[model samples]
Target chain A: MEIVRIIVLALAGLLGGVFGGMGMGGGTILIPLLTIFGGVPQHAAQAVNLVSFVPMAAGAIILHIRNKLIRFKGALYIIIPAALSSAGASLLAGLTEADVLKRAFGGFMILLALYSFWSEFFSQKARKAKLPAHDAPTV
Target chain B: MNGIAKKIILLACGLVIGFINGFFGGGGGLITVPVLERVAGLKTKSAHATAILIILPITVASAVIYIIAGKFDFGYGLPAGLGVIAGGVLGAAALSKLSNKLIRVAFAAIMLAAGIKLLFF
Candidate 1:
């Protein structure tokens, strides 16, 4: 049973990484996989995702930095506000009920899926009229 | 555009990104990439890479809070993290060859299905 659980979690991580490593938001699916299938609590699953992403992203971020793929210019503008607000939200999340967070996440996921569908099918065509999309990969 | 205007836009976008990421524990990259491209005027590659750059600090901050809040689960987090790191290599290597649209459409379906399941079930 322990081995099976490990396999399941590992598989979940692999799936999340395959998508997330590609920058498609692996945690979106990961949290759900944990809660719905793994019998993991919502808060724990979210924390797992957060903790897991650290090491997963570490090597990639370093590679990106070494390749000069990252632009440091004006980055603090985004980082500062993002860090502060995320910290605040993190506190709020701890205070919120698990079910409420799950519901909100469900709603957010649906919205993101709809937006992704539109972007995949139609946004490029519309965007074509504006500027050439030099699409690039990041994770 | 102008420097101050761009800074303001980045700052506003950052606030949104951080709140979403911290509250949910993920998805910052999705929003960050587009913001980097459209608002920051980064090329796509740069946007994606920089999205990671931006997401890392926010994620770290959230993780710290979550851990301190007593949410750490080594049993759940370890294997998963290892798997993600392994899969990251495959995904990165496959990125150049894969048809992104195909992958995305398929993933989108899964996302919708998962969303429904989470919502009602």
Candidate 2:
């Protein structure tokens, strides 16, 4: 059983790396697999899921930085408040009603999924409409 | 059934999967829970605890790398972290009362949509 879990972890890591490189939230995959296939409880699964984000994010961050994919200026605007607020939120989560959180979480994921789809659709359309680099005016 | 096996399994899973999570962001919590519950024979609570333990280290380590490179955004991370931490505790408390299966199904449906979005739109 332990061995099986080890194998699952390894496989999950690989999937995470590939998906993360693409900028997808590998957590989507990780959390579900852990809960359903691995039999971990939801809350514990979430906590453990948070723990695993560090290393996985590091590699992707490096590549994105090198490729100039990261927007630091924008990140600064978002990260500070987000960090402070998230901590507060976590504490509040400790205190708040459970059912509300569950529904909210579920809704959040659904919205993200929809947004991702919408963004992709627009991006594709824009790409199709795009002109050659030299022909297109600079922004 | 035993302590050593559980710890060992957890550790190994954390190391390899954590690395993947560090690298890709795919496996961590999603994979950890099921492995802990089914393979390690832990209850839902125990599995959740195990998952959190794994994530704490992995997230910190990855964040450190970004920090060293001067790319780490305290702003983004902090807010997100704050939200997550607050959300996490709430989620944690809710874990016992709510149906994880329902959450799983919802998540899966969302993921499917996300995946399709990735593929087509």
Candidate 3:
């Protein structure tokens, strides 16, 4: 059973990596896997997820770089301020009760999800409609 | 939008993203990807890839804080770290092969699940 737990943890990481590599944060998936199945404590699960992200992000970035997928222009606009706020926020998180923050974030995610679905389908339909049906597939 | 407005949005969004990443201990990408697409004018695949870059420093900064706080455990972190690294490489490579539409739908589904889980669980 201990072996099973370790394997589960690794498998969770694997799935997390795939998701993270795809540019989605793996922590959402990884933290739960560690907590629910791996029996990792909430704090520890978070720690593991954050720490694991270093290598995972590094690897994914390398591949993304090769593909020219990482848009570096104006990145500093986000990164500089974000890094500062995140550091401060992480420290504040350590000191505060997170339930309120967590709830608010949950609402944000739901909104984002709805937007993604709507935009994807609507835009695809619009794009399709704009093109003549007889146009050869531009490869 | 224009230069100043875009900068403002990016900075504002980054601040929010950082707060989410820090408070929740991860998942900044959920917001980062969309912010890049809508506010920053990044294409779909580029937004996904760029989100990681944007989060890396934030992750590292918070990770250092976690380590300093004695929150990290090598025992469990090692195996999972290895797995994640391998999987990340695979996923990055696979991104180019997958269609943008498929990626969008997949991301949406995960976002929904993640939202419910965060709210209820």
Candidate number with greatest TM-score:
1
Q: Residues A1-139, candidate 3, lDDT per residue (tens digit)?
A: 8788779888888888887776666677677666656777656667788888877678768878998888788888888888888889778766654465555555766777787788777676774565233211111
lDDT of 2 by residue, B1-121 (tens): 4655645554555454554444332334555555554445444444444344444444565444434434333322333333333343344345457664455445446566544433333
**C-alpha lDDT of all candidate models, in order:** 0.85, 0.44, 0.76
* Of 2 and 3, the candidate ranking higher by TM-score: 3
Q: Write the per-residue lDDT of candidate 2 for residues A1-139, one digit (tens) a residue.
A: 7667545544544443333333234566554454445544334444444544654444445544565433232122222332333343444444444344334444444555564455444555764574422211111
Error of 1 at B43 (Å): 1.7
On lDDT, the leading prediction is 1
* Residue range B1-121, candidate 1, lDDT tens digits: 6777877888999999999999998888888988888877778788888888888889999999999999878988888788878777777888889998898888889888988887877
Model 1 lDDT at residue A12:
83
Candidate 3 residue-wise lDDT, B1-121, digit = tens: 5678778888888898888787668878878876776676676678878888988899999889878877789878987888888887787788789886787687778768867776777
Chain B TM-score, one value per candidate, order as shown? 0.94, 0.68, 0.78
Worst 10 residues of 3 chain B by lDDT: B36-45
After superposing candidate 1 on the true structure, give the runs of residues whose Cα lies further than 4 Å from its correct spot: A133-139
Which docking category, incorrect, acceptable, medium or high, applies to candidate 3? medium
Models sorted by TM-score, best on top: 1, 3, 2
How well does each candidate reproduce the native contacts, as fnat?
0.74, 0.04, 0.73
In Å, residue B111's CA in model 2 sits off its true spot by: 0.4
